[model samples]
Target chain A: MTSSFLWTLRSFKHFVNGSSICQAGPVEKRGRGRRPAAQVRGEILDAAGKLLLDEGMGAFTIERVAAEAGASKTTIYKWWASKGALALDGYFHAVESTLAFPDTGDIERDLLTQIRAFARLLTRTRAGRVIAELIGQAQTDEDLAAALLEHYSGPRRQLAVAAMERARERGELAAGVDFEVVVDQLWGACYHRLLLPNLPITEKFATSLVRNVLRGIRA
Target chain B: MTSSFLWTLRSFKHFVNGSSICQAGPVEKRGRGRRPAAQVRGEILDAAGKLLLDEGMGAFTIERVAAEAGASKTTIYKWWASKGALALDGYFHAVESTLAFPDTGDIERDLLTQIRAFARLLTRTRAGRVIAELIGQAQTDEDLAAALLEHYSGPRRQLAVAAMERARERGELAAGVDFEVVVDQLWGACYHRLLLPNLPITEKFATSLVRNVLRGIRA
Candidate 1:
């Protein structure tokens, strides 16, 4: 296997927007008579993802992944340092396939689309349960929190922040709108509803939310 | 012990803001030998709080509370239907003593005070950990979620909404502000930081948060 194969293990976004790097593209292979490392890595992530979907976070264990993937514990550890790392990789793989960043050029509409999609994902999918489990786990587990922040949340927030910056340049947003605060309020509202489940996170709610916040930010 | 002793068991917030019925002179006794039910109730709550503080949610059991309070199982069951109910009472007892509603008459300042106090309670107290435990538990436990919504989150949210309504009536808020959305954003930001611990929910942050949202809502 080429270094790119190892790179696949290290980097996510293997597939996006109707195209998959894992297929329909050239893969650099350097070895003969041995399966490519990329294939092994893909198998591991698939097993991890299945385990998460099947039994939720409670049953997500590195040892269990080893058994499910028919690989040794050392082999699993060599690829991913801990269960948190492995589970995150699996989570990203799941989330990326299902959700897309909105870029409709209309900032308010884009935000509505993005947040509504997010709310739906958290409330409607099996992945929501897994995300909730990890969030609860992250409260006390510093290591898991760090991994999730670095891999999952950080990239997602960057995308949203970039969208806001683009809107500012387009004169869609006011001169002194703090994107961080706006982003926090938007995302935080959805998260609060998810955690509490006392309020409904309907599409209408998302639309009203974006409109209300944008009223202040719009020039 | 008179029926007034039993009344103490049924009522919460018996007193607030410096005047407490519990400590406002002695009561006339109607029974000769029975212990005060209020004292018994206090012992149970204290024991439950201690268990939550010393060991955490895992060790918080009704059986354990019975042992800790030196009360019989039947007696404990007579008051609370489940561990969640008992723990919630303990949590409320802790929270009520420490936090107070903000009524500074300045809408922005009132919000800042309320949210800052909330952030401090969640970050600086042992009850914070217990609350986190209950939030996580609520994700899976339907019954617990209902009880928390009714007893804890519902009332807390009502107070916040009332504050926003007061602001609107004072013409400090815009014509069409949704108090629920605003309340969600303010409280949610703090909760998001609490769960993730990636961001600081400092006093400055709380002040900034209230100011930012209020900018959107101000007339």
Candidate 2:
């Protein structure tokens, strides 16, 4: 996390408590705590994520996360408004590398590859279960829902949407096809299964979702 | 609310405590309590739905529902494995009538109408917020997730799917197209908004989603 990163967090009304999650300026923190806000946020997220994967959401708490991250609870709370926010960010931090959008220059193949990797992240890792917990809890937790839109799902969708926009720019997509809706058709389908449990999330399913989607929207 | 209704409740292992939620059978309850299990279930559900709509899920509780319905917590628990179960059933029971599929012989128009009406139920009523809470809470509660799949979302999807399948049989849909994914694409998009809070659910959005899908999958 950097100053650039703080921009996204700033947009979330519940997040960025008092201008920054950190009560101290970077120089002031260095003078006292020695660790910058970025460093503390990073450590908290890392610990929060590891704990989430190792034990799941039931065991996740601010106090435990603080102890694990070797930071104080005040510091952690300064950055994240609630456990749901932390869990989403932590889970996103943990899985971001594996879920990066691929630019293979072929829209269909790129989407399939990305969706397949995402499907694997959900099925093969604890990421799936953790996300299920975050989403489920977000129903009542307004802060978490806002963080999800601002910090997590919103950014995730932007990445996928950006990838599709690139495809459209390359003339591979039909004119006037709403890329966002196409995204909802593809990744939203995976999330539908994740939240509902009616359908299975698998590489095969991801492939079919992407392929079936392309068959409809391809130029 | 009947024996046939009991069949769906039975499939959920968490539900149907000791072969039935009601301790006494219809005859037994009739002799002693003067209410059949179906009638009791109906009353509980009615009370549950009323509370959920009037006060939302926070005000909803097994004890409260029991008191409101003039039943006992034990009775409510017998039929519902958990509050999640009760909430979903209560919500579905409350909203099922307005969401029925129309058989206008036009698959596209029918889908648009259904999705539009469903969107209205979400936007114009409390169903949207209640469902968001149900889906959010379902993440941690396996029993709720199972109940949602078996009782609510599963049955709801079947109605839309059955309607689409009829469209397929009538030579109105593409033969190889998967109706399930199509459902995911349509309603799932609305659900995506409900859960994520990024998009708004509206009659216009539903119509666009339905029209876009039919453009791809129509025969």
Candidate 3:
């Protein structure tokens, strides 16, 4: 009976020890030194984006971002020259990761795919909210506006223009059709619908838009 | 010589008095007691919108708005239950003044007219910035979101729908076309372009959009 009781106590101690180990594992690992550079950069951007989304542009201070990212403020300032630069980098990264241009070889299909993807991204993410804040801040901050235009608008537009050019090259475009104008129309309609909130963006609307734009430009 | 000096001094006195009058006129009038309700209401909304555009939603406090409007805090709170209520009123006023729908007899022409008007207003005014801000803020603030839909999106959509219906009644619309869907496409493109900078909301693009939409929807 004494031997059995001792054995039971030993088993209970082992169980308790095992449970404690499991519970303490994550906590003990919490302070593991600096993450890899790429990971640290990504984490910093994510925190900055969350700050921008939650508290507006004014809350996107370098110190706040660094604290949220679990990195030193000196580390962030070393990588980015200013808060605006950091914010711009974060904005650009968020947009690139989420909104990709479609190049399905058929202009109509490609455009439809692109528009729908963009509409979904804009409607469903904190990125959309961040964009609106950036736009508002842009009115007063010329440098930030220029950065947005360069990093966000410029690359996306070049992709769109290239896609339209490909359509023209493939003999899919009508004679005298302005490719730039067509691209603008497609992009404009998509942006307006997403931003205005006057109506929900439905798949049917996307189909009609693609059909209409293709009709306007098809050879 | 005495007469000339006296006249010069009198002129200087008059200039000083006029400057004081110009500076003090609004303050003196405000101090005289209650302003007309309609006038005060308009002033309050204008003040709120200015603050919203300049400083985003964060700066839109009762104290700030009341001070800017030159009205008592009690008067402002009497009309608006909260800052959000005041913001809603301000948003509607700003949007309505700048983005009224066209009613030209030709549906294509009218739609083009409205799109161009919206493009120009959004590009040029603080109204556009404010609208974008409100939309972003609405994503987080459910009350503001509902209020915006009820007051702004609902009315504007009704106007667009009415315009489409008028076209249908006039037999200008194709029998199988969905009017609501077409309007959404047209306006969506326009809104999308406005948010993206440096992309020309050009006359050429506008014409192509109308022509394309008409192609898809015309009887």
Candidate 4:
């Protein structure tokens, strides 16, 4: 894979509008061995995510992903710049719904809902394994690291940070609260446990973690 | 490396009394090719740390470590069960000193001190690179993950957790505070940045992070 991920407008817009999410584009041709382009796109992403999560990155290969995806190798190459790039996007696509930030009006409760969903994803799903691999690999993999920041972590944090800022504006949080750190504490704690696993990252732990942060920052 | 790490009393005690801090053990032997066991042991650890930090775990081999440390390959195998085991110990040996918890009586201040020190290590030293590699590799390397929990993250966290508990007892924190979550928010947020550097994890950030958690829990 190349050092930088090629971010198309659709990919970049995922954070702000989630438009990069796979939906069937218009299909004009129905021929032998041909599937809808968007359907194939979604399958390729699923294949990449499952390979990385279930089999680990050591076993990840573009060819294997193509075979599992039932998509032409050309199609995989047509989109992603590199395997690392695909993995970053594929991983985000696989897990983003579980972490979607809710706007429940009450900032504390909204955070709790999201955080608990995250804890469950980490505690119970393959998404946790996928994340562990992505994060673990990011330490040394510069391409993957850069793409993750640009495509995933940066955008994801902004969404949560903006949400908290809204909460602050609504008089639900202290005026001086650094929402970035608040997001860090809330989401980063789940990641710490996911990577470290010294302490359980349970739904119960999620409850207390959110409560403590809210306790610290509530207006 | 084997699945399980061989931890002797000296190794396990490092987290508790830090007696594993390499000292020149009683060694009278100085033959043509022989060195004091303790001195060689100390050198071996330093070499292992340097190898992992500079070259990464992929390049880490007992033979290479022996060549670098001037310790015998047999000596390397005798003490540690696997490469993962050695890397874990070497990493902790390299970093534990910098993360030492200060007992300055004021809970908030002590946290700021340690968190700032950790930020410096992560932000300034090769220690951060070593940690990133260790944590990143831990995703799929089961052996490394287990040993890190047993040797490093678990014991290290206990020391910090106990310190916070003492603060609560002293009426410095609210009785209802979950010190574990408090610890999670403060340290986990830093790790969040370390693994995913969307924001600058500076000493300034450390100061603000500690302030927020203390604001939440301070009695």
Report the error of model 3 at residue A180, Å: 4.2
> Which scores higher on TM-score, 1 or 2?
2
Clashing pairs in 1: none
What is the per-candidate TM-score for chain B? 0.66, 0.70, 0.65, 0.70
TM-score of structure candidate 4: 0.71
Chain A TM-score of candidate 3 vs. true chain A: 0.65
lDDT of 4 by residue, B51-76 (tens): 76566656778889888886667667
- Spell out the clash pairs found in candidate 2: A136-B136, B21-B78
TM-score of each: 0.65, 0.68, 0.56, 0.71
What is the Å distance of residue B108 in model 4 from its true position? 0.7
Give a tens-digit lDDT track for model 2, residues A1-219. Answer: 222223333344544333334545432143245676677777788888888767776677889988877777777666666666676577667888778888999888888888899888888777787667667656756665677677678888899888878887887776776667766777777888899979788776787676566664212
lDDT tens digits, residues A1-219, model 1?
112222333333332221232432222232343445567667678888777656666677888887776666776666565565577577676677555777878887788888888877776656777666666655655555675576676777778889988887777876665566666678877777777766887887677667667664211
Kindly report which residue stretches of model 4 are placed more than 4 angstroms away from their true locations once superposed: A1-90, A217-219, B1-91, B217-219
lDDT of 2 at A72: 77
Give, for candidate 4 chain A, the lowest lDDT window spanning 10 residues: A1-10
Better of 2 and 4 by TM-score: 4
| Cα misplacement distance, residue A147 of candidate 1 (Å) | 2.3
Ranking 1 against 2 by DockQ, winner: 2
Off by over 4 Å in 2: A1-90, A217-219, B1-90, B217-219
Arrange candidates by lDDT, descending. Answer: 4, 2, 1, 3
Q: After superposition, how far is residue A152 of candidate 2 from its true place, in Å?
A: 0.4
Can you write out model 3's per-residue Cα lDDT over B1-219, one digit (the tens) per residue?
222222222233233233211211222138767566667778888888767656656566789988988888877766665566566456556666656777777887788888777776666555565565555445444555555566566677788878878777787765656555555556655555555556656666667667766663111
